[model samples]
Target: PETVTAFQLQKQGSEGSSGERALGQQEGYRVDESGKVYLPFIGEVQAAGKTVMELRQEISMKLIAFFPDATVQVRFLNFRVTLIGEVARPNAYIIPNEQLNILEAIGMAGDFTPYARRNSVMVMRERNHQREFVRVNTQDTTLFKSPVFYLKPNDIVYVEPLKAKQYATQGDFLSRYSPIFFPLVTLATFVLGLSVR
Candidate 1:
């Protein structure tokens, strides 16, 4: 899926020429299941197997005959990442630009929580219809050299919580009844003070 914008440059002395006019607004082009994107004048172009830059060049070359002074810009609008688990916020984020690194993706999710196990971060990816999972330690400097360090579209990053977080929840029984327990304790203390006075 990509967004293609075509701008027609106008001459300085041209009357009624409003600088540049957009060809068809900011239209979003989605590649069909067969991996082709259909444009108005250019018909269908193979997009699935090609990068945004390649598609832009192909489109620009094709549009030369129609509008010689037209400038074409292509961008992937569907590039997204999923961040879950121990991060401060867990959600799917649509990145405006295609370029994204692991650290930037994590930062977008408000970074990892205090209980997050930074040493064990997992990235899930899909390749050739097969799922691939990779584990990397954020504390390890070697992670910079890992190929998975850079995130791809639809990649999922999961941060596991430390054992202490689990134990804290399980061992703290009062947390579940705080609403009633706090009121009862306050009433009991008030009654005892009145009797002593």
Candidate 2:
């Protein structure tokens, strides 16, 4: 069951009601570990493992006792994604809206670095307490149709570094030590020259 962040209650004729008012507005309501969200007048409703529409309907039904003319709208406020490994700025980002795609997530992370393997981007997701992994290739036109292309809340995108990046890092390490190695070699060469003389 997904968590519920906030809900909107539209009272048909309530005072000061300008269309709809966000119910449980302050910080929004979080579905407790017990898989329930407490509404103002409806008490608690099972929210976990249910879609926004399903929860909305449930809340609407519960509200029939209090406000028969009320309409409810529910949504998730904690929808987020994590971008890591070879991206320009890898971090977890909260999505204001539900709809998110792999490209948009990557872009939010400042796009992939030059070392990133564009053809082997990995997406890790968890569902029903089970984890799954999928690879995507941004270079392929078919990737747009892949199910993993649309990222889910808490989805992790990892851009693997290219082999060239590994070699380049190794080369950088050697270059940093080159100044120390250079002086030693020059001193050794001078000593050898005097010994030969």
lDDT of 2 at 22: 22
lDDT of every predicted structure (CA atoms) = 0.79, 0.79
Instruction: Give the local distance difference test score of model 1.
Output: 0.79
TM-score per model over all chains? 0.73, 0.76
Q: What is the RMSD, in Å, between candidate 1 and the native fold over all Cα?
A: 10.4
Model 2 lowest lDDT segment of ten = 14-23
* lDDT for each residue of candidate 2 in 1-197, tens digit (9 for 90 to 100): 12222344333222123322121222356678788988775678899888878888888888888677886667666666888999997877666565889998888788989999999999999988899999999999999999899988789899999999999999999899999989999999999999999
lDDT of 1 by residue, 1-197 (tens): 12233332222221114332111223366778798988767789988878879989999999888879878788755576888999997877766665888988888888999999999999999988899999999999988998899888789999999999998887586788888899999999999999999
Q: Give the TM-score of candidate 2.
A: 0.76
After superposition, the stretches of candidate 2 with alpha carbons farther than 4 Å from their true spots are 1-27, 182-197
For model 1, give the 10-residue run with minimal summed lDDT: 14-23
Clashes of each: 0, 3
